[model samples]
Target chain A: MIHPFQSVASNSDGSLLFFVIKNSILVYSVKDSNDEFKLVGEWSDEADSTAIIKEKVTKEQQRQLAENTAKKLKANDGTALPQEHKEAKIPKPGQGAPPIYQYIRNVKLSRDGKWLFACTDSDKAIVMFEISAEDKNNCLRLAKRQRLPKRPNAITTTIDDKQLIVADKFGDLYSFGVNDDQPCVNPEPILGHVSLLTDVAIGLDSNGKQLVFTSDRDEHIRITHFPQSFIIDKWLFGHKEFISTMCLPVWAPELLFSAGGESSIFSWNWQTGELLDRFNIAELIQPFLTENHLAPDRFQNKEGNLIEYSVSKIVTFDSLPLIAFFIEATKAIFTCQINRDSGKIALKQVLEVPYNVVSLACAETTGELIATLDNQNSHDKNFVAFISMDVDKFHINQSKQQKFDDFINSRLSDNEIANIEQEGIYPLYHVASLRKRGEH
Target chain B: MRAGMSLDDPSSRRQSYRAKKEENRKELKHVKIDAEVVAEKVELPKKRYYRQRAHSNPFSDHQLEYPLSPNDMDWRKLYPYFYDESKGDMTKEVTIADIGCGFGGLLIDLSPAFPDKLILGMEIRVQVTNYVEDRIIALRANNVKTNAYQNINVLRGNAMKFLPNFFHQAQLEKMFFCFPDPHFKQRKHKARIITNTLLSEYAYVLKEGGIIYTITDVLDLHEWMAKHLTEHPLFERLSQEWEDQDECVKIMRHATEEGKKVERKKGDKYVACFKRLPTPEII
Candidate 1:
C-alpha cells in the first residue's frame, strides 16, 4: 500500500511547498514556467529518534529543574511540601501512558519564510528548521528539537514572529523563542484550558493590541488579551461541538471562520463577541457523507446513523474574498465568497476530485491552491493536484501538474514503499476523533 | 430498606422504594392545605434516597444537554422570578457559581445572604441533582410570601467541561468548590477539581477581584488545591485575617454537608480562599 501524504504547507510566495510523509518532511520548490515542482530538500527523523533531544541533560540542569519544581509547589502556602515532592522525584514528560511509535503530525511555515516547524509524535518534540533567506539551493536546515511536556495538538507563532506558541493535547500553551537553539528543561505553560485544546490563533484588536484565540473540545472559543493571557477578553460560545479547524484571513482580520463537528461554518468578528454569520453546508456536503463517515460499531447510534462529519482544512485566498474548505475523508472541496460590506458568506463553488484530499495550501503571489491527496487508488500513484480560480469558480488543473509526480515517485525507493506498507500508515482522518463519544 | 436483599432484585426494589418516597412527598404537600395558607407547603426531598457514589469521571461523555452558548441558555425556567419577559432577558445574571455542589447546602445558605444575586449550583450526578432541584422548589414554595429562595437553582452539568457554554467571561463574582472529590490515587491527580489548567478556566469566568472559596476534609487534597491556586499567575492567596472577616468563608466552613459530616465525626476541615488578581501587564 502507498502511504498518503499526511499534511502540506507552503511559503508566503508559494515558491516552496512542504509535504509531510511518514517520517520525513519533503520540500519542493515550485517552477514559474511549467508550474511543476522540483525536489529540493528532505529532513527525516532518523537523526534523533530518542524521546529527548540530542543534547544530554547536564547534572546542573537536572538539579535546578528539581529545585524549581519544589519551589513551585511551595510558593505561598505555609504548609510543608507533599510527600512525593519531599522525596524530590524527577518529573516525567508524559505521565500516564507508556511510549509508542507515532507519525509526524503537521508542518508549519512562518510568514517571512525564514523558519519552519513540525511536531513529531515519536519524540514529542518540536523540530525546527532555519530556511536560508538568500540560498535557494540549501533550502531547509535542521535547527533545534525542543521536547514539550506533552504531545502538541496545534502550533503557531506570535503576531510579531518572535515566539513560537505550541498548544498541546493536555491543554497547556507554551512558548519558545523562534530562533532559540537551547533545549527547554521542564518549562511551565503560559496558559491552559481544562479540555483538550484543538486549535489556536492570534489576531489584533481595533487598537492593534494582540489577542489570542483558542478553541477546545468543549465547544469554547476564548479571546484573551495577548501576553496577558490570564485576562480573558471574551468567550465566543457559538459552537455546540468540538472545534478542530480555525482560519484567520489576512484580508479580513476582523472576521474569523471556525468549523469542526458541526455541519456549518461560523464566521465571527474577533474584536467583539458578535457572530457575523453561520453558513450551513449540510445540503451541499450530504453527497460526500458516505458510509465511511459512520461511527464504529461500539460507538454507533441506536439507529446506526452516520456520525457528524468534521471539517478538516479551511484556507482563505490572500488577494481575493474567496475561502476553501473540505470535510474530512471527502472528495469535494467547497469554496465560499465573502461579502465584506454585509459580512455575508455565499457558496461559490464545489470542486470534486477522484481521491481524498489530505490538506491544502495557498500560494499568495500566484493565487493557486496546492492540495495533497491520498493517491493509493490512483493507477499512476499521483499524490498532489493544483487548483486555480477561473472567472468566478475554482478549476482543478490536474493534467498540467502531472509532471511533478515523476519527481516524487523517483525520490522514494521501492523498498521504502514496501516498508511503509508493512508497518501500516498514520491516520489520515483524525478530526472525527475530536468528537466526544458517549462512552468514557 | 436492608442493605442487601438479593432475592428481591436490587433494581426493582430500589424502583419501588423511589415510588413510595415520591408518593409520601406528594401526600405531605396536599395533606396540610389550609384556607388561610395560599400556597401548599411542599416537603423537602429526603437525602438518603438520593445518595450516589461520590466520584464522577470528568472526561466521560455523560448524557448532558447544554445551550449552544450563554446567549442561547434559557434562564427563565431556572429562575422564573428573575426573568423580565418584556426585555426577553433575565433581570439579573447568575453571579455566583457552586461547582460540584453536592446536596447544595452552600447554595441554600448563600441564597438568603445575597438575596439580590442569582446563584447556580452545578452537579454531575442525576439523583443528587434531582434532590437539589426538589429541595429548591420546596424552599421556594414554603417561603413564597417573602420570596426567600427565588434566586437559587441547580442544574446537572460537568463543570470541568462546557463551563464557558453557560457563562461569559468576567460574568461571575464568586465561585465555590466545596468538598470536591479527593481522587486519592496518584495517577488521578489530573481528575482533581483544582489543577493548573482548570484554574485558568475558572479565572476566565471570574472577574477581577473575584474570590474562590474552597473547603475540604481531606488534608492531601486541601494542600494540593492550595498549592495549585497559589502557583497560578492570576490568583493570590487570601490571608487568615481576610478569611476570618469574609461572610462567605464563615458560611462555607459550616454550611456544606461534608463539613457537617466532618464535624459529627470530629475530623479536621481545611479552608483556603484565593482572590483573582488583575492580569499583569507585560513590560
Candidate 2:
C-alpha cells in the first residue's frame, strides 16, 4: 500500500512545503518556474520501534483482564467495582497505544517561513524546527521537543509569532514561548473547553483587538481575548455538528468559514458572532457519498444506514478572495467566492479529481491549490497535483494542472514499502470519525 | 440446533433484552404522563423505580438535544409562567444553575429562598433526570393556588459540554456543585467538575461577583476542588467566616440528598466557596 500524506502545509511565500508520513516529516522546496519539488530535509523520531511494540502488548493484556472482570461483575452502581477503580493506572503518552499514536497529528509553519512546528502522539510532544533553505541537504534543523501534559490535537502561533499555543485532546489550551527552553513540568492551561478541541486560530477584531478562536467536538466556536484568554468574548453557535476545520480569510479578515460533521459550510462575522450565510452542499455532493460514509457497526442503529461526512481541509487564497474546501473520502474539491461587503459566500465551482484527496494546501504566492491524493489504486507514483487558480476568471480550473514530482516516493526502500503494504496506510480520512452517533 | 432458536443463543438473549428495554421505556413514559398531563394534584414519583448507577461516562455522546445558542433555546416549554409569548422572550432568565443536580434536593430548597429568580437543575442520567422532572411537576400541581414551584424546573443536559448553549455571558448569578462524582482514579481526573480549564468556562457564564458553592463528603475531592478554584486567576476563595455568614452556603449544607446521607452516617462534610472576580486587564 502507498502512504498518503496525513497532513500538508505551505509557508508564507509558497517556496517551502511540509508533509507528514507516519511519525516522520518530509520537507520539499519548490525548485523553480516549472514547479518541481525538491527533497530538502527529513526528520523522524528516535524511539525504539521494537520496544514500543512489546510494551503495548503487555498493556493490552492488562486492560483486557480488567475489562473481563468488570463485565462479569455487572457493577453499574460502582460500589461493587472497587477492585477495578482501585487498580486503575495513570495514563502515559506512549504506552500500549495503537498505530495512530505513533503518527504525527498535524504540522504547521510560521508566517515568516523561518520555523516549522509539528505535534506527535508518540511522546505527546510538540517539535519545533528552524528552516534554513540555504543549506541544500538540511533545510530543517531540530530546535526543541517540548513534551505537553496531554496529546495535542491542533497548534498555532500568535500574530507576533512569539508564542506557540497548543490545543490538546483533554480540552486545554497552553501557550509556550517560541524560544523558551523551560522544562514545562506540570504547566497549567491558559484556556479550556469541556469538549475535545479540533482546531485553534488567531484573528483580529474590527478594532484590531487580538482574539483567539477555538472549535470543539461539540460544535462550539469560542472566541476569547488573546493574552487574557480567561476573558471569553463570545461564541459563534450555529453549527449543529462537531466542527473539524475553520478558515479565516485573509482578504476579508472579519469573515470566518467553518465546516465539520455537517454537510454545509457556515460563514460568520467573527466580531459580532452573527451567522452571515450557510452554503448547503448536501445536494451537490450526493454522488460522493459512498459505502465508506456509513456509520461504523458500533454506532449504527436498527436501520444501520446512517451516512455522515466532514470537511477535512479549508483553505483561502491570498491572491483572490476565494475559499476552497475538501470533504473526506471524496473525489472532488469545492470552491466558493465571497461577497466582500456582505460576508456571504456563493458556490463558484467544483473541481473533481481522479482520486480521493488526502489533504490540501494553498500556496500563498503561486496562487495554486495543492492536493495530496490516495494513489493506491493507480500505478502512478506522483501523489500531489497543483491546480491553477484563475483569479481573473473567478474560477479554480482543473485543466491547467501540474503534477508535483519529488524524489521522496522513488527513494523509499523496497523493504519500507513492503512494510507499509502489510500494515496498511496511515488513516488519511479521520474527520468523519469525529461525528457523534451517541454510542458508548 | 438452529442459531436463534436455542435457549442460550446470543441472538435470543439480545431479543429478550431489547424487549425488556422497550417495556421499561413505556413504563417511564406512563409515569411522566401521569405527573404532567393527566393529574391536577399529582403524586410524587417513587425513588425505587428510578434507581440508576451513580456514575456516567462524561465523554460518551448521550443522545442529548441542545439549542444552537442561547438565543435559540425555548425557555417557554420549561418555564411557561415566566415566558411572555407575545414578546417572544422570558420575563426573567434562569439566574441559578445546579450542575449534576442528583435528585434535585438543592433545587427544592433554594426555590422559595430566591422566589424572584428562575433556577434550573441540569442532570445527565436518563432515569434520574426523569425523576426530577416528575417531582417538579407534582410539586407545581399541588401548589397551584400559590404557584410555589413555578420558578424552578429541571433540564436534562450535559452541563459540562453545553452550559454556554443554555446561558448568555454573565447571565448566571449563582452556581452550585453538590456532591459531584469524585472520579477517584488518576487517569479520570480530567472528568472532575473543577479544574483550571473548566473554571474559565464557569467564569464565563457567571457575573463579576457571582458565587460558586461546593460541598462534598470526600476530603480528597474537597481539597482538589478547593485547590483548583483557588489557583484560578478569576476566582477568589471566600474565607470560612464568609461561608458561615452566607445564606446559600447554610442552605447547601443540609439541602442535598448526599448531605443527608452523610449526616445519617455521621460522616464529615467539607464546604468551599469562591467568588468570580473581574477579568484582569491585558498588559
Candidate 3:
C-alpha cells in the first residue's frame, strides 16, 4: 500500500511490512493469533537528511567550507578542473569540481528484510538501519545508524546479501561489508568506470552465478562478477544515448532493462552479452508528443533533432511482472511487461502522475494494479497508494485504443494537413522538378 | 453546389495564394527603394529591445533564423564599404569576425587599420546591433576622405549558429572573441563561446595560419578559453612574440568598450592568441 514512498518492503512471511514515508519508516505487523494488525514501530531519518541537505549549514561549517573553497580557488585561479580537462597546466588533486552535498535521493531496503540503506546525491554517504525486528508503530526503540561518505545514485544489497553495493555519481562502485549485522562505513572500491554512473542492479547469469549490472551516463551497461567486481565480465554497449536507469525485472532477471535519456529501452542478457530486444517506446508516448517533435521538457538535449523525451526513474515492482517506471518532463508512469516467451518488452499500461517523479521504489506488498491517487496539495500527504486487492487476476492490459490520435486529428485542420502532404512527397532525383515547383 | 466547397480545401486556396504572390513579386521587381524611401518606411520600430545593461539570458528571446548556406547570403549588404567602383561589383570578402561585438569599438578601430579587408561584427542583441549599425552608417556618411566604416558591418545574428552561413570556407584571417560574456557558473561553462564544438566551426571558416584573439577580465574564463583553444587540434598557442607584435591584439586589449571598462576598473585583462593549423591529411 506504500506505493508513492521512497521504498516499501514486506517480510518473507508477508506479516511485517514497512515503507519509508517522508523521513520516517512506518513498520506494520500483520501478526494475528485471532486476526489483528498493528503498526509496530517508527524511525526517522530527520537528523541525517538535515545534515545531508546542507542548505541549513551552520555558520561554523559555512566558514570552514568557504575557507576550503577559497584555498582551492586560489590553487585553481589560473587553471581549469584538471580531472575533467586534462590539459590544464597545474594538474592537482582535491582541486577539481566544487563539492556539492545534497540530501537523500534514495531509500533502499535489503532483500532479506534485515536492513534499510539510503544514499545521498551530494554528501556522498550511505546510511544503514536495522529493520529486522517486527515493529510496533512508534513503540520500538532503535540504535544509531552508521553513515558513510559518497553521493549515491542507487543502493542495493549484493547477491549474497552480505554486502551493500552503491552506485556513485563520481563513477565508482563501492562494496561495504556487513560486520555484526551492521554495515561498516569503510567501503572497498571494487570497480571503476569513466562516467557518472546512473544506476546499478543485482542479477544472475544463465549459469546461476550472481552478477553486478551497472549503467552510466556514457550509455554503457557493464556486467561484472558479484564477488570479483574488479574483473569486467562483459559490456552491453547498445544504448545510443546516456542510460539513467537499470533494472533486472524479477520476472525476467536474466534480461537487463536499461532506460533513461533515450526514446527506447534495451533488454540485454548479461551472461551471453547479447541484446535480447530493443523496445521502442515512442509509439506508446505518441499522444504526449508535441506534434512535430518529442516532448520538449523530456528530450530538450536531442542534438537539434528536437523530438525526443528522457526517462527519469525506472524500478521493478516485485509482485507485478511489469516494470514500474516513470518518465520525467512528461510526468508519466508506464508499466511494460517482458514477454518471456518472445523476449520482448510489451507496453502494458500508462498513467500520468501528479508531480515529477524524482525517484521510485518497489512496493510488492501492494497489488498488481499500479494505482495512484492524488491527495491534497501538501508536501507531506499529496500522493497515496493502496495495496489494491481487486487487481489480483492481473494480465498484460495493453490498451491499444489510443485517445491521443483523435486529439491530434482535432489539432490539425484539413488545410494544414494538405500543406504537410504537399511537402515534396518525394524529392527523389528530381532536381529540375524541384526548380519547377519553386522549392529552394 | 460543388462537392468539396468547404474552406478547408487547400489546393484551390494555394493556387489563389500563389497567383497573388506572383503578382506581388512582379510589383516588387518593378519598384525600388532609395535611401529616402527606406527612411520613409523604417521609422525605427520603437527600440523595445534596448537595455542599458546585459543579463545572462539577454539573447534568449532572440530567434535563430539563418540563411541555409554561404551562397544564400547577399554579401554586398554585409560589406557595403567594400563596394568596388572600378570593377562595379562587390567581391571583397570579410577576413575578420568580431563575435559578440558589443559596442563596435573593436570593429571601428580595425576598420581603418584593415581598409581593404572586410570586417563583420555579429551581435545578438537587436538594439545593440542597431546601435552599431547606426554608428557605422554615421561614420561612413560623415567621412569624405575614406571608405573606412563601409568595409565594416554589424549583423544581428548568433555567430555560433550562422558563422558558416555568413562566411565562405577559409574566408577569415583573424577572429576576435574580445571581452565575451563570462557565464561564470560551472553549469554555464558549455556556453562559454570557446567550447570545442564551436571551435571546430570557427576553424572551418578560418584560413590556415589565421589567428583567433581572445581577451577577458574574468580569470576563470581566461583560463577556460586558453585551455580549450590550446586543446583544440586545429589551433596552437601563439607565441608571446606574435602577441606583442600583432596590431589587432593591441586593439583587442584597449579598443572594446568592455576592455575600456575593465581598464578603468584596473582589472587584469588576460589575452591569449591561437593560430589555426593546417588541415590534417585524411587517409
Candidate 4:
C-alpha cells in the first residue's frame, strides 16, 4: 500500500534526488544502486510545527501536574505546596499534542542547488530556503519570503538564474531579481492567457534568451519573453481543454510537451509555434487494453481496486522517447513511446502500483521513473516509489538478474549479506533492484 | 657757362628759368594757402561708433550674463529662423538656453514639442554661429534668440565658463545632452561632467534631485554614467519593480533629435539618467 504522499525533485547535477513527504524534505544520494534511499539528511517543516505544539502541550501538562500535586500536598498536610516545588513537574513523553496542518505543494531546487524554493498554501507565500550541498546537517532554512499578489498557482526560476517568475491565480506574473534588496514587484502586465494559469516553464528561446511558457485554463500555451519587456513574441495554441501540465524537453530547447485535462498530449515546436505531433492516450490505451485483457481473477488489490482509472500524470526523460503516465484510479502506471519524427505511438508497459498514484517525474540524466502514491489508510500521507522501464534496465547486454546482482554486491558487505540471507532477502532484492536502476 | 651769362642761353637759361619759376610758385602757394586756411578755420573732432570691447582673454575677470529680452539679436538676421508662429503664445512658456550648443539643429527640432518652451542657442565659433543664426532667421523663429558676445553675453562663454556666475543654484529643472565628447583618457577624466565632483555641481544648479537625461554613442560612456549615478548616495537607480520603469531608456533612443541622427547612422546609443540627490548633511 502507498504509505505516504511523496514528491521527487532532482538536483541539477543529477547526483541527488530530493523527496518531499508531509512537512519534511529529504535528499538521497544516487551513488549507490540500492532501492534503499538512505537518509543523507532531512529538513522538517514539521520540527517547527511540532516544537510549537510540544511547547503548548508541555505547558498544559505541567500546569495540570502542578495542580494535582498541590491538591495532594494540601490534602495530606492541610496546607498548600510552595509555588517553586509545584512548578518542577515535567510533561510525560506521550502527552504532547499533534502538529498543525501544513501542506507542501511544491519544492524546487535552485539551478545551482544551493537554494530551495518551497510554496505552501498554508502561508500563501513562497519561501526561499538556503541549503548546503556538502553539509548534511545544513538543512533548509528560510532565507526570504516573497508574498504574491494573489495565491500563487506556480513558481519557477529562469534558466539564467537572474530572475524568478511567479504566476498567481489571477493571471498576474511577477518577475523579481534573485538578489534584489527590495521586495520583487510586477514591472508590467503580461496579457495573453484568459484564465487561471496552471503551470509555468521557463526555458531558452531560439536566440538562447529566456522565454516563459504558461499553460492556462483556456487550453492555450502562451510563450513570452521574461521581464515583460518583450511581451509580443508569440503564442502556441492546440490543447482542447485546460492544460494541466507543461514541461520543456530537458535536452532540447525547441521541443515542448504538454498534457491537457482531455487526456491529449502534444509535442510542439515552441520556437515556431508549430504542433509537431499529438496523441490521445485515452483512445490509444483503449485498444491496447482490449487486446491484452486479463482475467478478473488475476487482478490483485494490495491497497485498492486497480480498474476504473485513467492517466492523470505524465513525465518524459531525456534519452528516451517514452512518456511515463500514471493511471491514478487503477493504481497502474504506463510508459508510451512516441515516434515524434514519424508520428507513431506504442504502449510499452503497464505496471501496477501499491496505491493510487498522485504524481510522476522522470530523471533526465538517468531513465529512472518515479511516482508519488497515496499512502493507504493514511489520508494525509503518501509514499514516493521508483520503477525502472524494462528497456531502460536492460538496454544492451545487461540482464535484469545481472544488474540486480551487481547492485547488491556494491551496496552490502559480506557480513550484511550473510545476515540478510539468514533473516530475509525480499527487502534486500527490492532495494537492490531500485538501486541498480538508479531510482533512489 | 662758368661766366655769369644771360639766362636765355640753352641749358643755363633753362636752369635759371626753372629755379625762378619754382621760387615764384612756392612763394605764391604759401601766401595763398595761409591766407585761405586762416580765413575758413573751424575745429574738427575724431568720431567713434558704439563699439563693445572683446575681453583681453577669455579666462579674465569678465562675467557672462543672459539677455533679459531678445532685442537687436543677430539671430533674426540669419536665414531659416529656428522658431515659428506655430509655437504657442510665448508669454507663458519657459525659455531655456542651451549654451555652447554644438549644432543648434537639435534645439530647433525640440522647439515644436514644448510649443511654449522658447529655446535660445549660444555658440562660440563664427561659422556654426552664422549657420544656426541664419537657420533660425530663415525659419522666422520669433521665440529663439542668438547674438554675438565678446565679454559676458550668452553667445561666447563656454558652458563651464560662467555656469556658476550666470545661473543661480537650483534654477534648472532638466538638463540633457547626447554624445558629448568623451575625451577617453585617465588624464582627461575631469572633462566628463558625470563625475562625482561635477555631479555635485549639477545637483546644486539643478532643482532638488532634478532629472539629468544623458545619452552617448559610446558604450563605455553609458556604463560610466550608470555606475557613477547609481552609486551616488543621493541618487538611486529606479528599481526594476517600478511601474514606469525603463521609460527613460525608451525615450532615450527616439525622443532626442541627436538620437535620431545616431539612429540614422546605425550607431548604438547608450542612455542613462541621474536625479539630483538631496544635499548631504552638514557636519
Query: Which runs of model 2 end up more than 4 angstroms from their true locations?
Result: A49-101, A297-306, A391-403, A406-419, B1-41, B85-88
Better of 1 and 3 by lDDT: 1
* TM-scores (chain A) of the candidates: 0.86, 0.84, 0.64, 0.65
The number of the candidate with the highest DockQ is 2
Q: What is the TM-score of chain A in candidate 1?
A: 0.86
lDDT per residue as tens, model 4, A81-162: 5544333333434656643236456677766676677665444557676676556665555567676645566778877666
What TM-score goes with each of the models?
0.86, 0.86, 0.44, 0.43
What is the TM-score (0 to 1) of candidate 2? 0.86
Candidate 1 residue-wise lDDT, A54-130, digit = tens: 23334435565677676765525666555342333334468667545556889987777788999888567888998
Candidate 3 positional error at B68, Å: 30
On a 0 to 100 scale, what is the lDDT of residue A161 in model 2? 88
lDDT of 1 by residue, B185-251 (tens): 6557778889886788899889999999999999999999999999889999999999999999999
Residues A258-283, model 3: lDDT tens digits: 77766787777766667788888777
Model 4 CAPRI rating: incorrect
- Tens digits of per-residue lDDT, candidate 2, A16-68, equal 78888777888877754765667799887764545544555567657767777
How well is each residue in B97-194 modelled by candidate 3, as lDDT tens digits? Answer: 99999878999999888887888898876557766765665555455344446678877776753465567668899999988888876546545678
Interface RMSD of 1: 2.6
Q: How good is the docking of model 4, as DockQ?
A: 0.00
